[model samples]
Target: MKLNTVENLVRPVFPFTAIIGQEEMKLALILNVIDPSIGGVMIMGDRGTGKSTTIRAIADLLPEIEVVADDPFNSHPYNTDLMSEEVKESFNSQITLSQKKIKVPMVDLPLGATEDRLCGTIDIEKALKNGIKTFEPGLLAKANRGILYVDEVNLLDDHLVDLLLDAAASGWNTVEREGISIRHPARFVLVGSGNPEEGELRPQLLDRFGMHAEIRTVKDPDLRVKIVEERSAFDQNPLDYVESYRSTQDNLKERILAAQNILSDVHIDYDLKIKISEVCSQLDVDGLRGDIVTNRAAKALAAYKNEDSVTIEHIETVITLCLRHRLRKDPLESMNSGDKVDKVFQKVFQ
Candidate 1:
């Protein structure tokens, strides 16, 4: 289908605010939106828990970004390296910049996606026809300055997982194919969802996510009913359902933008930093990732709530999300990661 036709046929997404329950999943996604530098979020949960719904809603609600027009990677106007050589030449020839609202690209990495599809490939058509070694941007390029979402992430091939990890960590995609080398900024928020019953995620891959949130089916009858009703309404008339929640969605978008505006000014005092370290030390988290992620998540929460500084409350709210997957797993222990985090959190903060 034509792009516009496909987009037109696509039903409007259910608004973010309309999602019921799963507060941790919501918070983790919001935090990542507020600060992509917070790494990314890993959501492990049961099927039909709105994991995919919430992700699409988030993409729909994100504010638009400006880019150099016709740039395959959605390269920032000022970021020369991300632009094609033609765009660079146009810059010297007085290229006109344009702006348009876009639903932040949320590219899904499928289980069977090939390396070339993910990292892009050499333009064989151009090479064979015109003897030009042009490059074709791939999923990684398309995901630049947006979100890379992987469902059933634990089941992903090891090589693909490693590729994702490298992109997430380095914020760049460099593809050298058939002697044609290309590089571009591939900064994106990596979000993944999977069911643990399928299999455990690799520790290295698990550690890459800055925050981890586990969700379960809604147990409360009232909330479950509400969720069911909402889904039914959405399925009946997606456009009307989205319209009904537009105001709430706008409020959320405004709040996210406001938080981002004030995030740099939000402060974390030395004592709290020490406390964060103490908590990490007690938890036996490897390296300094947990501490750094914890600090970032705490500050992001404070910023999201329009606070000027990080506090114990902020730390408490974000500790579990940041440290959950970082803990060493024990085959003999059955305690939930959240419970372990809460225990350490209370002990350290108190």
Candidate 2:
């Protein structure tokens, strides 16, 4: 289940491009990868819709990045913002730090995880006995600059959700004990998936996710059969099935890398920004997060398409996914949230 912990173990990861249907889910993941600062994605759908499989595939699709060798936090070799304090000290000392390339870390947060496990614990006993502060790095430490996924996120405790939101927003994890403190970079793309049939996530918590993608069982008979056959083929011979899609996967990876490089330079028109806010205002979104995430997601979509400017098409494509979950829910109303968002968008943008 851990990508970084087991090196000797070899397992076949299904190629991202080989997956069938779930266009919205795949697009949300790709947009986040192209721009991790879009917060993270909230995927709500039917059970067994390839949520976990798609997540793993996306991680495997990415190319390796350079990190300071043997660092628990996966500290970047030269990026101070991504470097741990310890690595920063070494960097400041002009030490020649060794580096290695590794696939992006994919950390799965189990529902049973405790606070101490998610956030590293300060070793008070070691501090008292040896007069040296010791810290046991936790899941957050290992997930730095990677993807942190929480399955069945609706079932996770609210306090734990709060901690995750805080760390995700701040891009850092701080552990304090007995007046001693330890902090490090915990920046990552936070992906959470759950079944809507089970229960809906709290609106406040759901709002924190930058974009929300809802998927359903593929109803097209031929497409469903294709998906089944593909899964069967992959299960029968994972390596060969994965290899068949190597060219498509490489193209996807190259697009992601290129989009990331040009994201900062991507621009959005001032009139479009005003229209985005107008849509949010008309929808009665609680806060400005919808407007901001919409702007960011629009820019990301434009970048993903290799365009340097955000247009109405980019906004139209991403606005529903970004704002649907942010709207106030009516217990008595049966209308779909996405439909409501689209209606508001079309009205305002027109």
Measured by lDDT, the strongest candidate is 2
Q: What TM-score does candidate 1 reach?
A: 0.93
Off by over 4 Å in 1: 1-8, 79-94, 124-131
Collision count for each candidate, in order: 0, 0
Per-residue lDDT over 1-350 for candidate 1, one digit per residue giving the tens place of the 0 to 100 score: 45667777887888999998899999999999999889999999999999999998898899988777667888777667556556667776886766455668889998899999999988867887898878878899999989999999999998998898899888888887566677778889999999989997889789989999999998899988988898999999988888899899999999999999999999999999999999889989899999999999999999999999998999999999999899998988899888998998898888
TM-scores for every candidate against the unseen true structure: 0.93, 0.97
lDDT of 2 by residue, 1-350 (tens): 74664643677898899999999999999999988888999999999899999999999999899999999999999999999999999999999999999999999999999999999999999898898878899999999999999999999998999999889989999999898999999999999999987788889999999999999999999999999999999999987888899899999999999999999999998999999999999999999999999999999899989999999999999999999999888989788989999998889878
